[model samples]
Target: MEISSGVAAPETRKCPECGSAVPVDERYADWCSACDWNVDPGAADPEPGRIAAARRRLAQEYGDQLAAEMERAADGGGPPARDTATVLASGISLLVHGMTALLVVTGVLLVVLGWETGVQPVIGVLLLGTASVLRPRPVRLPKDAPVLYRADAPRLFELIDEVGAAIGTTGVDAVVVAPDANAAVTGYGLRGRRMLLLGLGLWEILPPQQRVALLGHELGHFAHGDIRRARLTHGALHSLSVWLHVLAPMPAVRLLDRFVNAATFVPRWAVYGLLLLLDRLTLRASQRAEYLADASAARAGSTEAAVGLMDRLLILGSVEAELRRESVAAQMLGGRGGREARDRAEEGLWERLALHAGAVPEHEYERLRRVAARRGHSVDSTHPPTHLRRRVAASGGSHPAQVVYEGPRAAAIAAELAPARTSLARRVIRDLAG
Candidate 1:
């Protein structure tokens, strides 16, 4: 295997193919005792920083708290779904919290850069504000953007309205389901229209209550004003990335393109790497928002249901994901939407290779994933970490709760939760009417 130029290993060598560590017998100096992975004794060992960064991300996701939550979610079946209003609050909390956290950080950047700190944050809030004002505007299912709901999300919109009424989720305009098992609500229209998308899988597997809870979580984003914040921040970043990429997709920007791809060298995982390090800071900021949403659910009198909703969502997103990898692959490459086969093939290879040996250390990768899986993938920033949510649920506390719920769950637990489950029937007619 070719060694990555930027990274070097420490002390022992590991097999790129199987990840078995090569033992030092000196007798078989060039070979791995377990996997026969070739080695170069002269290789420059990488500094410990890379491994350290990866370890932090893993620890944040899998920490004992996250693990316990996963277990609790399994035992609970799913949250109760009697009230829809509270659920909307929960979802909105996530969006608002995420935006507020980002703006807080951006404010720091502007201040430190000696720019108009007030102006920066004001601009940030305003940008997102535009999206927020139109937050409840639903996405009109377009022929171009086909509704591809995940197995989950059968009553997505109804729940959206049910929970939203309490949270002031207004003007439910349009809805669409993507093949991907993620949900997002957007404000569309020139002045900003309200829209939402629930991953079909989210609707499929999560118990109805959990489904409402999921909606609450998303709509909560709008309620907390996160939808607006996300809009501005994401828009700025997307434009900046695209413009900057024109200058430097790799590193240094040419003189003319300098303003364009300013963040070009900003690697994807690297940003997450930074966030991973600051996970606690992010969590601390978001936890409050979550509390508010949880309370929102409680106020709507669906506390137990909210918790159950969260549990079921955790269970489904994890298991269903593995079974539907092919669909994800299709959506990623735009399916038959007109991407070139050769280009798509190349992209696939790169994505597949990202998880391979020595791209980052195999032991390191496994170590992190092992920890992350304990809590499920959502701890990263999608939902409340299972532990925290379960704690509130069990405690009988209800408020807006927004914790990171971004990844897959434990397979065994998911399988157990998945059995005997029936998907909420899709109100395809409801979507078609629009």
Candidate 2:
């Protein structure tokens, strides 16, 4: 083993509240997503007394306010009636899919007619093939991939069921575990089946109730029909984009490409412009979805738990990047210690994260909330600022504390998947090494 002389590395800017590394490039942002810290030295400070008073008021009426909000939502008095944006987006999707289907059908009809009428229809056949390619590809999962099955992880499934019920959702079709520090709910298959993906890196760090809140938040998306609407908007946009890219003329064939591109320009631009407009129109709705999900999560779990989950997500990005760069990559660089090395590194990284995971700073949260309200999603942020979500969650109804397997039981659950987690960490480390 080669041991180098000890040397202190250059100091880097880090989010003081969350302890997450701040990229030199992104340091100018008004607020830190990690802990909502005002990262920019020149950022204006909010009035101290006003913020303190607001926080105190929030703490006092948080539960009752959220309960009333939830009641309003249940009564259909919350959130704009999904009309304007959904209609526009769904309309555009329908037009694209409809046109593509028509072209394919017309091509097929021409080809069939040609056989009887002795008219050449080669172009028609080609059009049919092109239309088929333009359609969205089926969602697929790799065979024999290491997924944490519901049967093997009964405790996890049970927890999901409990939280799902609380969030007004039914069964989850599948669950997948990976090494990252996050979780997401995705739609799978033609029938729109739901799959919950959990990151072991995040799971190991969170307490049991926090995990429930996280799950509740995700399941809320399903209950609120956000998943279905997203499939229509995002999925259609993705498929149409792929089609356009494939059909776009190559610069290499400049002379012929110009004519081809000119012929297709109008339709292509129309689709592109529609998607952009859709994003703009739905910005508020998208943000509203996040707030509503936070409410559901708070209702299912405790206010504290939902807030804790949001805080962790905001901060975990930097923590995750650091773990990949330092502990995981460092161990991988050494001679193969196999699964043992990966396990040790993972445990050590979790400990480090736990140490940094303290109470969220109040001033930081208030500053971020202000920044987010002013900035909106001009930066293409998928989710609303963590501060806003945190505030919304803080003002939610109370629930009995939920503990989903802890102590030895939690350890057993963790141990049962040691091999899988170790395998994933090694794979990630190898990828990073490259």
Candidate 3:
């Protein structure tokens, strides 16, 4: 098998369990393909807390059911009907917001009626302050956050606008670059102006077309109308989560505190139950939105590119490991323990990552797919299983790219992102060193 430059060819080794020849790449774990030995090495990682474990289990269950349902719908040529769960979820969300509104009105009334009484006015102000604290607020970028404005990256913005137009939504107001290995779309400010968050770790490794596919998938969340992304539902969910956190029972350290903790137990559980119910109600709709987004990705970037994006996603763990390995190797070779090592690590970081991603062979992809299936892995608790999404992308049939991004325009976008690339790489290396 051909290996890209900077990556060594895999050495063959006998699988201890099955006696089968396994291609062992130093970049990845050695696993027996014939008998499926050591396929899921991640299983040995530390167990998650109870809530996270439960959420993962629930996500896996919902993903399986939704994948089957979506497949059937595709085959039958009929979309599933809107169900009561969504309506019920929306209603509950509205009620939560209504409660917040009630608090605001009550606070105002107290202030208006008892303006003359010092104690009453003080209580009224406190109530108003509490209401303000609980109010739903739009997301805001940090002042020092790295942002790419249209003027600075016109070509990139134009490409984004083209994709947005194809997906039936206005383009983003700005692009925020971060060090994460993920991309997302979110709204900011009171007007809810959209923004695209591009993670450099993921972006630096993707081909131009696959990057377009990633954009399509994220922007699709807006075009496809994900209820969870809607301000009303999202705000309510946030408020409820906050309520749950606030109502949690505290450890009793004294006699009076014991009584207080005891009194709060029922209310704490009540809030917990409500949050769980709301999550369950919205689960199916949120998952359906993901599938729809994948369809949009296929349409915008072509099915082939979308499928390739999924393949990239499947091996993100390996990508991350490789990045850390590079950082460590650079640090050791540099011989200096401080800024010099970090600078050495940051240099050629993106180039090395791109090559490492490119060097992943077809067999490795297949192995990751099998491991994903075995582990019931998804991008997160919110996303559907990656394998299922990949299948959907492939089954959507061939599609011509709706908005092409290549040549000089692509180079221009890269040029615009150069500063961000350097900063993000330095940040990653510094973090690893620390």
TM-score of 1: 0.41
Alpha-carbon deviation at 365 in model 1, angstroms: 23
How many clashes does the backbone of model 3 have?
A: 0
TM-score of each: 0.41, 0.71, 0.90
Ranking by TM-score: 3, 2, 1
TM-score winner, 1 or 3? 3
Candidate 2 lDDT tens digits, 1-434? 99867985534476778887644332224445676566434443342553233332332333334344545665567644444666776787777678778888889888887776655478678888878777765554435335666778776677778778777787587777776777778777787777877776677667777877778888888877662247666666666666657656557467678887887788777655665555555544555666778877777767778877776665465457655675546566355877666556655554455554443345344444455444331112445545556665675555555435457656667666676676666565555445
Best by lDDT: 3
- Report the C-alpha lDDT of model 3 over 324-400, residue by residue, as the tens digit: 77767766766756667668778889998899899988878888999777776678776777888888777766887
* Overall lDDT per candidate, in order of appearance: 0.44, 0.62, 0.81
Estimate candidate 2's alpha-carbon lDDT, on a 0 to 1 scale: 0.62
Residues 113-165, model 1: lDDT tens digits: 63554576566555455444423333245564434232333333444566777
